[model samples]
Each structure stands twice: as structure tokens, then as C-alpha cells.
Target: MSKPVIDIAIGLLLHHGKVLVGWREAKQHQGNKYEFPGGKVESGESPEDACRREIYEEVGIGIKQWYAFDRIQHEYEDIIVYLHLFYAYVPDDLLTLIQQPWTWYHRDQLMQLNFPKANDTILQRLFWSHFIKIGDKLSEFQPHADSLFYWRVDAEQFQRDVLHTYSADDLTKLILNDEHYQQLSDDLKPLIKTLHLKQHQLMQFKKGDLELGKRYIAACHDLVALQHAEQIGCEAVFVSPIQPTQTHPHTKALGWTQLEEWSKQSQVLVFALGGLHPNDLAQAQLHGAYGIAGIRNF
Candidate 1:
């Protein structure tokens, strides 16, 4: 007999650099394990609505806004589950009012807790830092344990120098632009785990054309492209021109409202790019960005 399939909406309530999680009751299916607060998605109910309802029902906190973080499918002995994850930020004042059984754990501390097997993927992803640095010269910036580096240099120079300096493990925190990625040899490809697709590249992209193990992230300027990125298997999208930039001073900025709107509309993580600086990370997060990416301020 086939296992029953279920859809679940999981919320990672983030506040003050921590996530709100609850202990699973001993009578529950996955008893004694810690789980993010959420429940099953009822028939005819959208995952977003399911998440909002479940969060409120389980935690008694109502959230008007949340960003799509990720989706995962896992199978247990008797059932299959499709987990839809969302991220919501709760204010400091509201954090104090949360009831018992819901505990705040620092992002790093989550790894130490015993969670259901299905949560392993999200736990690894949650450990990624919220800042991405984009630039042409890799040597200009010092390496950071938590941050990701996107080296925007030409394909020839990248292939010639990158492998000699960084290992496959090191490349996990690095991102290569699509142009450079396509030019790399098959053997050299595994060294790159993340690809950053430009607007033009994303427009012409076809699924399965890229390597299977790599994570694709796209640069988008509008809602259409952001949706397209999600449709084409992009795990993250960088919505750009959120602020005025020296490189394109005359280009109109999308601003924070548009950023939040697009973030809510897409299923992938959203990064606010273009003219954003390190100091703008908090503001970007408030506007629904998973992080901030920049060429100069990173």
C-alpha cells in the first residue's frame, strides 16, 4: 500500500536573531522532537493561508506578512509530506507575550535540537548568513565564515584562478555568474555549487540545461522575471534597483514596497540588490528580503 501524502505549512517565526519553535507532544506522530510551529494544509486552502492559520492556532500570534522561504518533500515509513516553509519577523514587544511551549532559539542553536528528519534541509539552509558580497575582484574582500561571495569576474580569469585557491567545500559559500559557469569544464563544474543568473540569462534559461547539483539564483528587476525565476527552478531571486545607484543614477528604483510585494508573490527566497549597503540589511529584511546583495557595500 502507498503511504498517504500530506501537505504541511511550516512557519519559522524569526525575532531578535532567533526562531520560535515548539516541542512536539509525546502523543503526536513525531513525538519528542522539536518542530517549527505549523500544521497540515486543509483542502481548498492555500499554503500561505494554511501557514497563517496554523501559526495563529498553535502559537496565538497573528502575522499579517510572511515571505516564502522554501519547500521540501520527505517520506517517512507510513506517509509522505510536502513541507512549505515561510519566514515571518515578530516585533520585540510581541516576542515577550508569546506563551509557553514556544521557545526562541538562536539560529545556530537550532542545530543542536532534535528535530524530525524532514527538517534537516531547512536547518542547514537557515545557517546561511544574510549577507552576500558581489564584486569583480575576489581578493579585495576578506573571507567571512558566515557570508557568501559572488565573484563577478570574467569566465577565463575565474576558471584559471578559483580552483587553485578554493576547494569544493570553500566554493559552497561562493557564487559564480552564469556566464562564467557555462564556460567551465565538466570536471571544474562541481567546484561551483551556486550560479547567479543575470536578467538576460534568466530570460533565456531552460530547465535541466545547468548542472543538477547546483543551486540557481537569478537577478530580477520586475515581478514577471521574479516569477519566471521561481518557475525555472531558481532557489533564490535577487530583486534589484531597490535604491538609487551611481552606476545607473537615472534608473528608477523599485523601493521597499515593491520588494515586499514581489517577495510575497514568489516561492523562492528574495534578496534586495542594487544600491543597498551593509547597513541596509535590517531595512531590507523588514521589507521581506531574505538578505541583501551588493557590489560595493558588501
Candidate 2:
């Protein structure tokens, strides 16, 4: 017989840039794992009511506002869980009311902790939406010419300077080579808005493997590369060398005509890269390009 699903309500309480998490006690179902504090819905109780009551019982705090985030179903060896997730804004002063051992973790730090297998799907969705929403909101006020910024840096430079200076609101995405992508710490991964991968790096993994719970864009120079990126469900693709570039001056440029032809064929958003300047944005868009990416032009 199939296992029955247990309906549970969970809340992610956010304060500042962190979310509240509690360490499960030894006697609990998923012992020693970190979880967003919540419990199963009682008979006749709504999910939101259960969530609020559970939080008060567990941590002695009352939350007035929460937005429904997602509903996830996961099957474990013994039971199937139907988790109803919600996101709420909590006051900093309410931290003193926590009765159990709890900590406020930044989005990046949550990846390093041990969570129940059932929570993985909801966790990924939460962080992905969090960063993307920030990016969308920031873009609304910025100039159209500054819509995107390409960050091309070595691993050392990224950690030493880029991490300290730039934030998700500061750039559209950070493009990294294979070596630099591999060198990033687990705690730093969630802070990335959209991570751009080189062609070879993207080829090493299947659709879901390269997903670090972030939006991904892949570099493409040919039809095969573009198709591969689309097959893997990349958010965007970068088609380069539209004009002579100082970095690769020896290679011939794919001029506007070819760039437009390729862009029209792309299943995913096409970013016109290589020798691009702010002045080229309008022209690139005229040819079906989503946006332009560059190294020094920004």
C-alpha cells in the first residue's frame, strides 16, 4: 500500500538578511537536522493557523503577516510529506523570545547545514526566488543601459575584492570560468544572482547537476552549443565575438547579420557579447538580442 501523506505547515521567518532555523531535538522525527520551525496541521485548522500556532508554541512569538510561498510533496522511506511553505517578515527584537536553540542564517549559509531530504525542494525554491526577486526589483529603478553587468574575474580576485565590493543588487549576474566556479565556497553560492558558465563547464553536467539553486546562463559560440544550453534549460546564452575584441583580436568577428541570424534561432534569451559598448545595446536589441554582456564596456 502507498504511504499516506502528512500535511504540515512551515514558516520561513526573515529578519534583516537572515532566516530563523531551529536545531531539531534528538527525539524528533528528523533528529539533529536543521528545520524551519513548524508542525503538522491539526484537525479543522488551516495551514496558516497551524503555522502561526506552532511557531508560538515552539518559540513564543506571534507573526501577523506571512505570504504563501510553495507547496511541496516528497516521499521518504516511511512517510510522504506534503509541506505547505510560507515566508514572513519578523522583527529583530523578537529573537529574544526563542525558547530553543536557534540561529539566524543568511541565504548562503543555509546550504552548508544538514536538512531533512524532504526539505531540499522547498529550500531550493525559496533561495532561488529570493535572489531573483531582489534582482527584478533593483532593475526597475536602474537605467536601461545599465541593465546588465558582466563580472569576469579570477577566483582569487573574486574572493578578495568582488565579494567585498559587489552585491546581488549591484550586478545582473556574475560570469565565471570552470576554475573560478569550482573554487567558490558553499556559503558564497546563494549570494550569486545569475551564474554564467563557460561552454566546457556546462557540458560536464546534466540539466539539474549544474543547478546550484540559481539562474544559469551558458556561453555559446555555435549552433551545437546553443542547442545544448537550451536542452539543459539555461536561462540565457551568450553569443560572442560580434565585433573585433582586444582580448581575442586574432579571431574574426561574427558581425551584425550573423549575430541576428543566430539570435533568431536561439530557444533561450540571447546575449550579444564581445566588443560590445553601451551604444551597441539598442542595435543588439533590434536583432533579437535579450541584452549585451561585456568585460570592460560596463
Candidate 3:
């Protein structure tokens, strides 16, 4: 009738390379389909409260804590459904897929899934890429160039808003505080293993001012640093403003062609800045950028 919209809670139950997906009774209209483990929100509940309730009812276990994720607003039929979604990281053994309505699929086995929306990129990104992994033991986080969460804060003040909140006792933070590296709030320092230096902070004393709520990626523009990254032992650099940015409208960006050329000579990892988003990571990689770093996306 009314584009049957429902509040759903999905669980990512992974075990032996398989993830659990659930559906309703095999032949109903919205049935016989696989989705995350969740259901509708009761009349008096908040989405978070509803998500917890729905997961326990459908999967018969509790989610110790869930990360706040996307708010998907989509059109399911003649009407629009604003689905406030979250991700719950549960153990692999917590799942029991003997229920006729449930099945488990691995990352490589997506072709075998029957969910109508699984084909949409949203599902892949939501379940696979977006969730920041937590609760892993120290032995699990093998430090490599791969798992680093790189970000660029607009000098000293910006760090207060973006980097301050995600603190847990264990996460190690590496920041290029530019000129103000010494100015970081003392309370924030004990929580992290801090490394502050001049070369990484090139953008710190740049010509223009930063915009509120808009943070772009950029190469720190220290040719000296580029020559000495190996000697200095640094991993990445931000080269930016390939397009006109509000913060540095006059600072002509070293466009993609130049970035490619520069990248070949520099041993340090490179990222394209200016105006960027999470989706830009792929484009960045193609152009010799190891990853994209920006405050706007984080």
C-alpha cells in the first residue's frame, strides 16, 4: 500500500569468511530476501534504541555497542523512506544461521546473495568500507602502511573539533600541527604518541586562512622535505588545490599532471588535496596518491 517502509537493524555476522543475511518467510513480497539483521522501530523508541531491540529479537543476542553510521534516505516505492542506519560489530560465533530465513555470504560470494539492494553500491560501502573497526586485540592491529587513518586538520583550532572526540586509550595519533604543534592542548597530548615537526607542517603558516567546516587535502609544499623524507623518516605529504578552493583561491594548485611528475621523484606517499571526498581515494590512487586525506570527509 504505502511503499511499505520499515526501520531495520542489520548485523554483520562474519564467521569463517561468511556474513549472515536474513530475510522474511520464503515467498512474501518483501520476503525471501537477505538483509542486515534488524526490523521496524516501535512507536515510542529512538532509532538507536530500536536498532538494539530489533537486533536482539531477530538474532537473539545483544550488541555491546554500535557505531553511529549513515542515515540513508531513499525511495522504496511511491513514497520515500528515511532509514537511519548504524553498524554493530558482533563476533563470528554469535551467529546461528540454521534459521530457514537466514543465510551467510562472504565478500567474494556476493553474486550468490538474493537481496534486491545488495547490488547497489550503498550496501557494499555501508557494510564493508564505512565501519571503523574496533574491539580488535593488540595482536590484531599489525602496523603497516595500509591501516593508517590519515587526516589533515586546518592548523591548531581545527584539531580541537575533529581529532579530539574519537579518542580511546589505545589509538596512536600522528599529526602535522604545522607551526602550532607546540600549541596543542596539554590534556590532549597524554592520550597520544605525539610526533611534531616542521616539514610536515608546511601548510601551517601558508598564505590564506581556513574556512569553517571545509577542510581540503594538500601537499605540504616543502621541496626540502620532499628531498629528505627518507632521511627524516616520514610517510606521506599533501599536495593540493588542484582546483580553486575557498581557503586558498589565489594559491594555484599543482594540477594532476604536475602531481604525477612530482610523485615519481618523491619517495614519500602523496595525496591530492584542495576539494576532496572519500570517493576520491580511487582517483587519488590512480594518480600515484597512496590515499586521500581531508577534514571534510572525516
Q: Using TM-score as the measure, which candidate wins?
A: 1
Is candidate 2 or 3 superior in TM-score? 2
lDDT, candidate 1, 95-213, per-residue tens: 66677889888776888999999999788766556788887887754455567888888755674455557666676788888788777777777677788898889989864454444
- What are the lDDT scores of the predictions, listed in order? 0.80, 0.68, 0.49
Q: Write the per-residue lDDT of candidate 2 for residues 54-158, one digit (tens) a residue.
A: 888987899876656567788888889889876666666677887767688866578778999988765654342111111212223232232444455555455
TM-score of 3: 0.39
Q: Best-fitting candidate, measured by lDDT?
A: 1
Per-residue CA lDDT of model 3 for 1-298, tens digit only, reads 5676665544444343345677656675456666766666778888878877776777677766554444565675454555655544445456553344566665445545666553243344322221111111222332332333333334433434334645543334233333433455767644433233344443243322322111222345545555453223333455665555667778876676776776666544565666666677777667766555544343
- Give the lDDT of residue 46 in candidate 2: 97
Task: State every prediction's TM-score relative to the real structure.
Answer: 0.62, 0.49, 0.39
- Arranged by lDDT with the best first, the candidates are 1, 2, 3
**Regions of candidate 3 where Cα sits further than 4 Å from its true position:** 1-6, 14-17, 26-29, 92-101, 126-298
For candidate 3, what is the lDDT?
Answer: 0.49
Span of 10 residues, lowest total lDDT, candidate 2: 129-138
Prediction RMSDs, each to the true structure = 7.5, 15.9, 17.1
For model 1, state the Cα shift of residue 25 in Å. 9.7
